[model samples]
Target chain A: MTIYLPIAELSVNIFVILGMGAAVGFLSGMFGVGGGFLITPLLIFYNVPPVVAVATGANQVVASSVSGAISHFRRGTLDIKLGLMLLAGGLAGATVGIWIFSFLRRLGQLDLVISLLYVIFLGFVGGLMLIESINAIRKTRKGVVPVKAPGQHPWIHRLPFKMRFKKSKIYLSVIPVIGIGFGIGVLTSVMGVGGGFIMVPAMIYLLRVPTNVVVGTSLFQIIFTTAYTTVVQAATNYSVDIVLAFILMVAGVVGAQYGVRVGQKLRGEQLRALLALLVLAVGIRLALQLVITPADVYSLAIGGVHG
Target chain B: MKRALLATLTLLGLVAASPAPAFAQALSPPAQGSVVERLEIGMNTSQIAITPDFAGADLAIFGAVVNADELLNSIGQYDIVVTLEGPKDFATVRRKERVFGIWINRHSVTFKEAPMSYTLSSTRKIEGEPGVPPLDAPGIGIQHIDLTPTDFLRGGRLLEDFRDAYRRLKMESGLYQPDPGGVRFISSTLFQANLKLPANIPSGTHTVRAALFKSGKFIMEKTLPLRVVKTGLEQAITDAAHQQPLLYGMASVFLALLTGWGASVLFRRD
Candidate 1:
C-alpha cells in the first residue's frame, strides 16, 4: 500500500525507515559503536539531505549511547573519573568543532573536507587495528602469554604535569588529555560522528585508561555531546526534528544492547581487529572520492527558514 | 479497411461512453465576449523567470486573488481562486486551492481601494497595508507556493502554522494513520503540494481549469493557457539536498580544514 512519508514528501513503504532503523540498530548493538557510519550513508542512499541526516543521526547517537552507557554502568565497567575528564574534553571539543563548522561553511567546502578526513582516518586506523588484533589473536591461540597489563611507555612518565589515575594506576600529563579532547572534537564536527571510535582507542593507548573504562568514557562523552549537538542544531539550525531522532533512537537502543553482548563474546584482539578493519574500509572509500573526479557534484544552502 | 474503420468507430464509441454530467448539472461554458484584459499569472518571486527544460511541463501559478468587493466585506471564511483555462500541459496529479484571510487592522479598515488589476497582481508585489488583503497574498496556489520558510516565521500565516504544528504532534505521537495506499497525509500548513508528472505525459496545449471552493462551491475560476516547455532545476536540487546532505556537509568541512589548519596552527602559536 502507498504510504505518504512526511519526510520524503512521497508515498513509500512504511517499513523502509523503520526497517532501516532496526537494521542499523541491530548491527550497532551487535557491535560496540554507534551505527552512524552505516545509518548516515543509508539515509544518504535514500536521498535524505545531509544536514538532516547528520542532525538526526546525532540525535540517534544520544539514545543509543545512553542505553549502552546504562548497561555498562550496571556492569560496573564504567570508569567515572576517566569518563568525567573525557567529558570535559569532549564538551570543549564539540564547541570548537561547532565553530569550525560555521567557519568552513562560510568558505563553502565542508562536505569535501569531511569525506576526505573520514576516509583517511577511518581507513588508516581501521587497517592498523585490524592487523594488530589479528596478530594478537593468532599469538594468543598459539599459547603465547597474553600481556597482563598495558605496557608503560617511558614517555608517559616523562611528560610534565603527571597526575595519578587511581583506577588506571597511571599518572599522565593533562596536556595530552586536553589534546586528545581537541582532536576528537575536530573529528566529530568534521565527520558528523560521535568520535567514540577515536575516543576509546585514545583513552586506552594514549591516556593509559583501562580498557573497561574506554567504552564507558566514550559513551559518557557521546551522550552529552550529541544531546547538546541536537539541541543546538535544532534550535539554531532548525535541523533537528525530535520525531525523527526518537524513532531511530528507539531502534538503536535495542541494537546497541545486542551489539554489546556480541562484542563481549569475542576476544579483545579480535574485536579490535574487526573494528579497525571496518574503519579502514570506510576511510579508504571516502579517500577515493577525494582523489577521483566525482561522477556528479553539487552544492546547496539552507533554503528553508529557521525558527 | 474494415478493421481500420471499426477501430476508429470503436475509439469514437469509447469516447462517447465516458461519463458526462446531466445537462442541468453540467458546468456552464465560460462567459461569452469576455475581454482578455492583459492576462498574467500571479506568482511568487521565486517562481519568476521559471524556465522549463523538459518537454510537456506544467508551470505553477500562485499568489492570485479575485477582487470582488462584495465578497471581501462579508467574510468570516471565504475562498479565493484563480483558474487557468485555455492551453495547459500535463495532467493534474493533485490540486488544492488555498485561501488565507487575515483580519483587517484598525488603520486600514476604512481604506477603500478599487478592484485590483491583473497588472502587478502577484501577491509578492502587493503594495498594500497590513490587513487581510495584504497579510496573505489574496489568492495563493496551494500546489505552487512553498510555505515551509514562511511557516517557520514567528507570526506568518497562523492557520497554516497551527495545522503544521498539529500534524507534527500527531505524527510524533504515532497517532497519525496511513491511508489504504500506505500514504499518510498529515495536513499541510505549508503552501505547496508537489504535482507528480506521469511518465507518458503528452505534449501540446490543453485547457487548464482552476477554481476555489468554500463549502463545496466554486467561488472563483481562472483560465489561462500556458505552453509546456521543460521542467526546471528545482527537482534536481531538491533530490540532491535530500540524498546527500552529509556528503555535501563533509566536503564543505574538508575544504575549510585545508585552509583552517593554518588558522588552527596560528592560533596555537598565539
Candidate 2:
C-alpha cells in the first residue's frame, strides 16, 4: 500500500504514476492523443480536486508533445507552415471554448453538455475511421486503387482565399481549415485537452493532408495550445504547479521515445483501430455517468487519506 | 498566672507548625497531562548569554523545570504549555493558551492548571544575541526557567504582517525574494510563535517566559529572558534570501526539471 502525503494524496505511487504516465505518453507519441482522457480520470480516482486535475493534465500535454515533436522533426516529417496555420486557428478556437465552458458552468450544465459532446464526437469519429481503415485494407489486398468519397460540398470548394498545402498536395480554401482548427481549439479549451486526437483525423480525412504531416502538425498544435493554457492558468488561476509539470514532463519524454520505436513496427491500420477503441472506451465512460445512478451518495471525505 | 501561661503556650505552637504545610505540597502531573520546559532571562540580556535569569513581560511570569523527576516515568502524558506574561506586545500573547507541546489525538491545548505530562528534550542557558536561530527548527538552543504567561506573543494577523515586513526589510537590505517554500507540516503536528514589536514599542529590554502545560495544567515552564533591541534579527533571514534570489529561482526550476525528467526516465521502458 502506498501512502501518499499531502500533495500526493491524489498522486498514485510514484511507480504507478510513472507507469501510467509511460502508457499515456507512449500512446500520445504514437497517435498524437493528448492523454488527458486517461490522466484526468486517474487523478479523479485518486481524489485530486477535479478542476486542478484537469488543468494539470493539460499542462503535461505540452511536455508529451515536445518529445513526439522532436522525433517527428528528426524524421523530416514536420510541416511548419501547416502547423502554424492550425495553431493560429487553434488559439482562436481555444479562447472561444473557454468562454463556452464558463457559460455552460454558469448555467449548471457544463458536465452534461461536455459528456454529450464527447459521446457524439468519439462515436462518430471512431466508427468512421473503422470503416475507412477496413476499406483501405481490402483495397490493398486486391491490388486495386482505393476510391475515396469526393468532398463535393460546393461551398467548401468555392469559399474565398484558396491556399496551397504543398505537403498535402491540395489547394483548398483556407476558411474550412481555419474553421476546423478553431472548432478543435474550442473543444480543447473546454475539455482541457491537447486536441491531437480530433485534429489528426480531421487533417487526414477532411483536409486531405498527407499522413506524415498529420501527426506532426497535430503535435505542433498541441504544443502551442498547451503552452498557451499553461500561461493562462498560471497567471489567472495560479493552478499550474511547476513541480507537477516537471514530473509529468520527465515521464512523458521517455515514454515518447519508446512509443515512437514501437509505433514504427506496427501497421497503420492496427494503430488507428487501437486509437479508435481507446477513444470509444473513454466516450462510453463519460456517457455512462449521465444515465447511471451513482453507486454512492453523500461522499465521505474532501480528500483521500494518502493516495 | 495560669491563664497567661496557657495563652503563651498556644502562641508558641502556632509558630512551630507554619513550615509543615509548605513542605508537604508537591506539584504532580495530572492523569493525562504533559509538560514543556524553556529557560527565560531578563529582556536586556545578550542573545548569546548562557545563564538562567528571571524575566517579566506585562508582568507575565514563566517557569522552567529545574527538577522534574516526578514526571519522568509516568503512564499518562505530560503535555507542555508555555506562556509569556506581562506586556501584550505581540498577538501570540493573547493565544497563550494555544502554545504547547501535544500528544497524538489529544484535545486542543488544555485549559486547566493541573500538572501535565512531559518528556525532557534538553536544558540550557538561553542566549540572547544578534544571531539566535529560530526555536522551532528542532534543535538544542537557549534555555531559561520561568513561569509567566505574557512572555511570548503570536497571532495570525501578526504573523502575516511580520512576514510582509520581513519581506520589505529583505528588499531594503539588498536581499532576494522568490517563492516562499511549501508548508511541509500541518497545524497540529507543528506550530510557530513569533513575537514582533510595534514601531512605538520601547527600545529596551523585554522579558518573556515560555510555560509548559499538559492536560490543561501547567507542568514545566521556561523564560526567554532576552531584550528587544533597536536592531532587527528576523531581517537577517530575509536578507539571506534576497541576497540569493538566483539560487532560489534556479532551485525552483531545477526541482521542476528533475521531477519532470525523472518521471520520463523512470516510466520509460527499454
Candidate 3:
C-alpha cells in the first residue's frame, strides 16, 4: 500500500517505510543506540526530501530513545544533573544548527553538506569502533580481563568551572559537558540523529564516565534534544512528516522489543563489531554518491519542489 | 460616391485583421482568409477540488469561433492553441559541477515569475506547417511561455541553455505537458481542448488561455480562471502546517511523546 507523506508531499510504499523503521529499530535496540543515524539516510535513499527526512528523523529518535530512558531511570543509572547540563548545551546548539540548515537550503547546498557530514562522522566512528572491538575480542580469547586504568585525567580536567558528578564519581568541567551536548544537539537537528552513538563513546573515553551510567545518561539527554529539534523543525522549516514519523516510531518500538531479547544472547564485542560494519557500509554508500557523476547536472525547483 | 464606397471596404478589412484583445478565443483548427474572428471559451468545471485519492485530472475546455469565414474554416487553415498556466512564482534552477572530487551545485539562475506548471493543448501542432510560421504570441505554447531570467543574463548563449534546461526539466517532471493533437473540432465552429493536469499541479488561481490563429496569424485570444484546491486530509494538514505552525509543531511533539510513552507502557517489563 502507498501512503502519502503530507510534509514530504510524496506517496511512498507503506511496506518499504515500515520495513526500514523495523530494521533500524532492531539494530538500535540490539546495540543500545537511538537509530536516528540509520533512519535519516534510509529515508533519503527512499527518495524522501532531505528536509523532511531530517526533521522526521529527530522525531523518530524520541520514540526509540523513550523506552531505553525509562528503563535506565528505573535502575537509577541516569545522572539527572549531568543530563541537565547537557540539555542546556544541546538546546543552544540546536538553535544554531537550525539557522545553519536554513542557510544551506537557500544556498542550494544542503544536500551536499549533509552527505559530507554523514560520510565523515560515520566513517571515523565506525573505524574506531571496529578496531576497538576487534582488540576486545582478541583479549577475551586470551582470557585476559579488559581493565581501564584509572586516576589519569587528561588536559580536559584542568579546565575551569569544574563540578562533581556524584553519580559518575567524577569531577568534570561543565564547559566540556556543555560542549559535547551542544555538538550532539546540532547533529540531532541537522542530521536527524539522537547523537547517542557519538555521545556514548565520548562519555566513556573522554569524560571517563562509568559504562553503566553512559548509555542511560546519553539516552536521557538524547530524548530531550531530539524532541526539541523535532518541535523547532516543525515550527520553522515545517518539514516534519507526522504520518511518516508515526509509522516509523510504531515499527521501531516493536522491532526494538525483539531486538533486545536477541541482544542478550550475543556477546558485547561481537555485537559492536557487527554494528561497526553496518555503520561503515552506510558511510561508504554515501561517499560513493558524493563522487559519482550525476545523470543530470541541471535541476529545476519551482516553488521549492516543482510540480 | 465611388470613393466613399471604397473607403468603407478598406475600413471593414482593417477591422477583420486587427488585433482583438476583446475577442473570446477557442482551440480548434484555424482556417485561412479570415473575414473576422471572435473567440469564447469555457470550462466543464470552474474549480477542481482535489480529493485524497487524486491522481490527476484531464480537463476539457470548450471554445467556439464566432463570425469565422466559412470557406477558410472548411479549408482547415485555422489552428487553436489552449494553454493552462498555474500560479506564478520566482523559480531557481541549479546546475551541479564536480568540484574537488565531489558533485556540488555551482551555478544557479532565477526565472522571474514563472508558472509552477504549464499544460498546453492544440489542434494540429502548435509549431505546425513547413512554410507557415508559428504563432507570434509568446504566451501561446509550452516553448513560447515566458521564462525571462532575473539575473546573470550576460550576452553569452548561457541564458538560453539555462532556459532550455529549466523547460526540459519541467517537461520531464510532468510540470510542463503538451498535447499536439489534444484539441478537436466537435462541430464546424466549436472546438474542445484537453489539458492534462498533473497530480502535483500547484493549488491556486490558474489561468487557461485559448488563442485563435488564422493561417498562422493571431486572430484573437480568451482567458478563463481556474481554482485548484486540496480537500480532505491533505488540506487539513497543509493548512495547519502553514497557518498554525506553532500549534502544529507542538502537536507533532505531543504525538511523538504519546507514541513513545505508549509503547514503553505496553511492553513494560513486569
Best by lDDT: 3
For candidate 2, give the docking quality class from DockQ. Answer: incorrect
Candidate 3 docking: what grade? Answer: acceptable
Residue A88 C-alpha lDDT in model 3? 93
Candidate 1 residue B8 C-alpha distance from true site, Å: 28
Model 3 C-alpha RMSD vs. true structure (Å) is: 6.4
Which pairs of residues collide in candidate 3? B24-B39, B25-B39, B29-B78, B30-B77, B30-B78, B30-B79, B31-B77, B31-B78
What's the CA error at residue B170 for candidate 3, in Å? 1.9
lDDT score, candidate 1, position B182: 16
Question: What is the Cα-based lDDT of residue B108 in candidate 1?
Answer: 6
The sequence of per-residue lDDT tens digits that candidate 3 reaches over residues A1-307 is: 6666666765677789889878876765555577776788789878676778888887887776665666556566678899899889988987888787767767766667787978998899889878887888889899988776433567898899999998888998999999988887777666656767777766766787765566668767877777777877888888888888989988876776556556555676676677678778778977987788989999766555321
TM-scores for all predictions: 0.54, 0.54, 0.81
- Taken in order, the candidates have interface RMSDs of 20.5, 17.5, 3.7
Can you tell me which runs of candidate 3 are displaced by over 4 Å? A3-5, A27-49, A71-82, A95-121, A149-175, A186-194, A208-216, A259-265, A304-307, B1-35, B129-133, B152-155
Q: Residue A272 lDDT in model 1?
A: 72
| Model 1 ranges off by over 4 Å | A1-12, A26-32, A107-118, A148-152, A160-171, A291-295, A298-307, B1-270
Best by TM-score: 3
Query: In model 1 chain B, where is the ten-residue run with the lowest total lDDT?
Result: B108-117
Number of the top DockQ candidate: 3
Candidate 2, residues A1-307: lDDT per residue as tens digits? 2322222212234566666667777887788777888887876675554555665666677777767766766666667777888888888998898898888767763555575778788888877777776766676678886465545456678888898877657788888888899999988878777767788878877887766667766776777676666556544544444434555666776787677667656666566666677767766776665455554211211111111
